[model samples]
Structure formats: structure tokens, C-alpha cells
Target: MPDSPKEEVDETGGPDLISFADMPDRLEAAGLTRISKQRCRQLAEEDPAWPVPLDKALKVGRMRLFDWRVLEPYFRNRTPRQGQRTDLKPPATEA
Candidate 1:
């Protein structure tokens, strides 16, 4: 079966280098809603910060492409896992 134009192909199974300037329209047209273009640009810019907000990413530059897996969680709004709390430390592991 032929794929529809609305669906993007990532048979490469990896992230593709993408430009932030063009990412807004491509992402929008693909039906992927994001926090904002500015935030998208922040990811494009590879900022060194955790929990980057949408509006503060305007100072970014166009950069590389990323994989669907890499970006999926950002666009997909999900609920927090059950029985989880940040106040507690993760279970220690021995290797």
C-alpha cells in the first residue's frame, strides 16, 4: 500500500537533520502539535538546559534533523506514571 502524503517516512530508523526555520511548517502540516515554534527552535539549537520552555527558544539557529522516536514524546502529551514520586531516589543498582 502506498503511504499518504500526510505521513512522513523515516525508514532510516534514525533522526534526520532538520532546519528549525523550516521545521515549524513541516511539523504543523504533519499534524504534530508542539508547545510552540520557539520551543522547537530550542531543540533545533540543542540548548544545554533541562525543561526548556516554548517561548524562550527564539534565540536558536537552524540545525540537524532528529528521529521520530527522539521527538515523539515531546509532541505526545502523556500522563505521569503511577506509583512514582520524584522526592524518592531511584532504586540503587549493582552491576
Candidate 2:
């Protein structure tokens, strides 16, 4: 059996670096991250932050690309763990 275009691997014997278009599914499958291309675009429009700048996407031709190694941490951190509250609570009101 031969590898499909989408499954092509690199010299490192890992999946080839992919374009932003392919990120959502790949990230989910790899258990590395979960972000839609649309969400990624939205993030790209926002102000920069630390560690991984969600908006810092690179362009190759007309396609946007992101390094999985760099993005994995951001996604992992964003994902809400089981039975854990990921949202912030409002401050207590004063009487």
C-alpha cells in the first residue's frame, strides 16, 4: 500500500509539515491541539501574546502555515480538562 498525499511523510519519518488548512484535523488526531481554520484566522487578527502568538502565522504562497511544535502548547493549554472549569469567574460584589 502507498501513502496518500495527505499522509506524506518527511525525511524525519514524521508527517510532513502541513498548511493551515490542514491544521484542525491533524491537530485533533495528534492530540496536540484543536482549532478551526476560521478560529486561527480570528486569532491572527488579535494582539500578540506570550509563548505562542496565535496570530503569528506564516504564509507560503497563498497558504498559511504553522509549526505544530509551536502550536501544540497553546492548544493543549486552551483545551479544558475533564471536570475542570476553564472559564474565569467574576469578582465578588461589595454590599
Candidate 3:
């Protein structure tokens, strides 16, 4: 029987490995932030604080793959903390 397109064999020819193209959707499905390939690449280039490190990306020919298990924590940590606001001003006191 032929495997489904979504199911990719790993180097050891074990269970299915998630593909890079499907990463964003997987992240969303897992309740993590959804980031596109372009966005991931952009962050890698521009942001030193990017959650997923470039080294984590596995290059297979022209495709780039990632492990969701490894990335999930990073995404969760990236969320802004409660009560944290960039725009805030103190109220003026009556003179």
C-alpha cells in the first residue's frame, strides 16, 4: 500500500515525519502560533530572538523540515506575559 502524501518516512524509515510546508498548520492545530515559511525565514534573518533556531531546520533537498515537539515550547514561551504593555502612561494628578 502506498503512504499518504502527508506521511513522510524518516531516515530510519520509521513513522511519518512532518513536512516543513505543513508546519504552520500543525502549529495552529497544536494551539501554537502559526508562522509561515517565509515568516520563519524572515525571523531567522532579522530577529536574534527568534524562537526556532536555524540549526533545528533539517534540509532535505530543496525542502526544509522541523520537529514540532522541539518548536512547541519556543512558541509557547514567545507569547507575551499578562499585564505587559508597550504603551502606558501615568495618570496626571490634580494640582
Candidate 4:
């Protein structure tokens, strides 16, 4: 067992540890698709499915560190949304 549950083993028996600051790179490394830090913050703020931090008391400045085990499933099963806004479609041209 790790000194902290935040570094605990995942369900798959692999080491699971991550920080909010490193989330984008870690997600990209796992082939889960990269996202911006701003997007990460958005998810943390707006996404209900976002995993809860294992160590809520711990903080790196204002950002919270999270367990990778908890996040892996969320990102892996995330529904892909269109990159462009649906309402932003250009006006149809007359033939």
C-alpha cells in the first residue's frame, strides 16, 4: 500500500497517480486524446462524470490532484462531441 490512497493501485492492479497539472499529458500518453488545461478545468467544474479527487485536502496551489485510476474510465468512455459548434454552421449558398 502507498503512503497515500492517492497513489494506490488501480482496479487493474497497476499504479495509479496523477495531478491536475499533468492530466493532459497523462491522458495523451494513455491514448485517450489530449485536452487543454482549460478544458480540464472545464470538465472539473462542469462535468458531472468527472472523478472525485482522492486527496481533496491536498492541493498544488489551487488545483487538486486526482487518482488516475478514477479518471481512466471516465476519459475512456467519454462521448466524443463535435469540435465545431452546431449553431455555427455557415449559411447555405443559393445554387
TM-score for each of the candidates: 0.37, 0.51, 0.51, 0.63
| Whole-structure CA lDDT of model 2 | 0.61
lDDT of 3 by residue, 22-77 (tens): 76787788777778867655656666676556676667887666665555666677
Residue-level lDDT of model 1, residues 1-95, one tens digit each, is 98867535556644443445565666676576534567665554564432334343333354344444445555454332345577798877999
Candidate 4 local Cα displacement, residue 41, angstroms: 0.9
Model 4 steric clash pairs: none
Q: How many clashing residue pairs, candidate 2?
A: 0
| Candidate 4 global Cα RMSD | 7.4
Deviating ranges (above 4 Å) for candidate 2: 1-16, 50-57, 79-95
Worst 10 residues of 4 by lDDT: 51-60
Error of 1 at 49 (Å): 9.6
* Candidate 4 Cα errors over 4 Å, as ranges: 1-15, 53-57, 83-95
How close is each model in CA RMSD to the real structure? 11.1, 6.7, 6.9, 7.4
Candidate 2, 1-95: lDDT as tens digits: 97766633455876345566777887789766567877666655552532345345565777766666666566666644344554776767999
* Candidate 4 Cα deviation (angstroms), residue 18: 2.2
The candidate, 1 or 2, that scores higher on TM-score is 2
